[model samples]
Target: MSPEQRLASLLAMHGENELVEFKEAKNQYAFDKLGKYFSALSNEANLCGQSRAWLVLGVKDDRTVVGTQFRTKTADLMSLKKEIADKVTHRLTFIAIHEVAHPQGRVLLFEIPAAPQGLPIAWDGHYFGRDGESLGALNIEEIERIRLQNRADDWSAVTLPEASLEDLDPEAIEQARKSFARKNPRLIAELEAWDTPTFLNKAKLTINGKITRTAILLLGLPEAAHWLNPSSATISWILKDRDGLERDYQHFSCPLLLSVDEVFHKIRNLKYRYLVEGTLFPEEVEQYDPYIIREALNNAIAHQDYTLGGKISLVEFEDDRLCFSNEGGFIPGSIESVIHADAPETRYRNRFLADAMVNLNMIDTIGSGIRKMFQIQRNRFFPLPEYRLNERRVQVTIIGRVLDQAYARKLAACPELSLDDIMLLDRVQKQQPITDQQARHLKKRGLIEGRKPNYYISAELAEQSGDKAEYIRYRAFDDQHYKQMIIECLEKFKTARRSDIDRLLLDKLPDVLDANQKHHKVKNLMQSLKNQGLIENDGRIWRLSNP
Candidate 1:
């Protein structure tokens, strides 16, 4: 059978189960419900070890093909991709939206890819799982099951009995010793007294003096990689120009303890200078935070799925953004939880490796590192790190440089704003959409102006910050200004068409409004004028009431 026939057959064969959901969206369907089902079906598919899940919109619970008139327009139908991506974890969206024309009626098939093995897909910050034929919070047991997938037989903790301490790099071991000493200042003398094998054991890099995969990753010589055969232990740093052409690239192998430093040194930490409004001097800072860079790199190394045989990547862009990615799903369910709670992760992808890194002072076990990255950027008035977690890997982007000078100045002016509030305002500056809850919070504080999806810094904020121009730009003139414009248009032409009135006022309206909304704004202005006896609209034409 053909692909479409195959899909139809599958839908006919299955009822609402963990991997399939049936909805009779004859005329319209709730978009929010679609997002929830996407989350539920994706998680359910992962739990059942399925490659994909089905969401049939035109099908009823009893498996009847009623057809759907939902989002009939191609553009509107396709826009669901972005709408769903905005709120889903890892930006997960439908893999494909298929329309099947059957002998009985039409059918809409939403093909959703399964969630990553270890990461549960969440819609609007809530994980959904299928409970029989209904949807509910992913059961604690299921959540734990997903988390355990990442904890599977940590390759880094596996012992390589034949490998000896001789396979380790002496320089790497010395560096490890210093890091461990710094981490344990009180035990410095004791740490120094131990030999290589003893120190490795004490540092948890070895299993009772027996070489392990973690030992080879952090302290193994380049040639020792053979001991871990098949599992690759390497980090590749690649630089790309504006055109995406490779400008420079280098790979660092085993002995990651020192190679991490080598990778850091290769990056061009240029000085970024931004003008501080109301001051003659410009504030200068590094493109990227040194601590953030190290933390991200070490986190990648500590959490990397070594058994996957994929190399970690550090990709640098000419636009001053650095991306660090490793082969594994994020151990923490979400980055927001880590940032807001600032609590230690309850589990780790590579527990032994993470413990060793913590002992060496490479990463913080308290889970403050990611939060620190956000705080550092907030203090600098730069964008926070962007995290993209997927089934195959966890990627983070550290944006450097001030994206908007006005935004930075506003931050400086408003010292009382919390980091969370600043983050929302930062999204506003970047033209990214904020959640309704966030919009209401910002609106309640009089910190934002205009309708959502186009909210900008409010005039109140601008006035407080001495940004008179921005205040005027974001806050369009009041009813009087629009009223005056309508009167002027009528005066210029004895009678005006509704289209003419729109032409006079639409462009002058707030940029936040769409074309249809702008048209309504013009009609509302005409009605207000008519109510005041200043103008009258005789169906198609508008004119001064007296005229």
Candidate 2:
């Protein structure tokens, strides 16, 4: 219905409902308060299984239209959509702000869309909902109920009405055929007899000879990208210098079947050379395993949320590391589950895209994809893949070279340690914190020791690896050791400055503590000695206790 007809229909209602809110903003409305109502109504719409909610300005809570002069100009009023989008979750805003000239006066009807599936809408980090016409915080149960609506409808499984075989690139289709034949080698001779449309159907890239978004993304010509409209199929490859400056960049649009190779070749996979502790000759290997680059890129393409209209990004930093980022939170939730699970994850952000890629030999959901990435890096003595997952994006960084050449070979020596166990130990070595539960699990294996945020490889593992000295650097010393040293230094030096005390014990502190933390540690230690009447201080200087 037209905006005028819809407004009249809503006006005839007995009172305001969960999907509609009426406001008499005679002169102005608070932007923040407006945002809260937007969040509340949007969330309520999702919960009620409705597509949209309305916020009618110039209309009172009693359904009386008194007219509003809020942003009377058209451009000024429409800009509110962007204003709301900037602060709301996922940048989702109004479908349209409808203006209606009613018999009462001029009314502004603000259209708000429903929250995206599985993700709740929040205004300034707070969720709001309606309690029988009263606005309040969305309760935990309601919030979870909204969040649990995870992608109920699969966008990738949809077929585009305007797309056909003519839109597909010839070269990309040929590559797809080669990949599919290779994946199903038993059908090689039979595949030669199949036609283009017939082959695409068999490969699951189309439905009943109709092109799917997956087909357009993987094999469709560049011009066919328009069929996906608001969602583009683009992969961006960027190269950066050691200083994190972008030196070169390229954006590859459909057909992505061939662009994957182009993007891979653009990455400078130089040879990484490192020497083992006991060896004179430097061991050499390719900076990135070929499978790693392909798997990571394909995984990004397979899991990317195309509805966001963002490009999959692969950044190569001076040939040392490759960081691949896609626009979507991880479907499997955590990298831990993917690494530790014996089976593959059936959940995917783009199920149809991932399945087609598997048929095209671009990706595999089996353990060979993610789990093998870790094992390959482990076998090469490199750090395990790093996953940075959050609400809107998933980024994975692959370190191309060994961090500690000495400990790397030794880490390999821990054959009894599972890949998952070593993965957590790798975090400890990098000074990354593990949960208390994780620490306890590792401690039970005698593979780690010390406290949270300062855990170190255990003494037994250190002895086995013959890196006891390195272990001591990570291990923190007792406070008594530091206190006695300070007392002894004061006795010999008469009056030592704060710097002198720092010099005495700063290097003796745990390597994990940064400069500021080490200074804080010294401050605490000096305060402890003073409280015990073990030392006398003259402001900047300290002397031995005077009884």
The lDDT of each candidate is 0.83, 0.84
Residue-by-residue lDDT tens digits, candidate 1, 334-365: 67546554556656778899999999999977
The C-alpha stretches of model 1 lying farther than 4 A from their native spots are 1-152, 477-547
497 Cα displacement, candidate 1 (Å)? 16
TM-score of 1: 0.66
lDDT of 1: 0.83
Q: Give the number of the best model, judged by lDDT.
A: 2
Steric overlap count per candidate: 0, 1
- Candidate 2, pairs of clashing residues: 118-149
Q: What lDDT score goes with residue 442 in model 1?
A: 82
TM-score of each: 0.66, 0.70
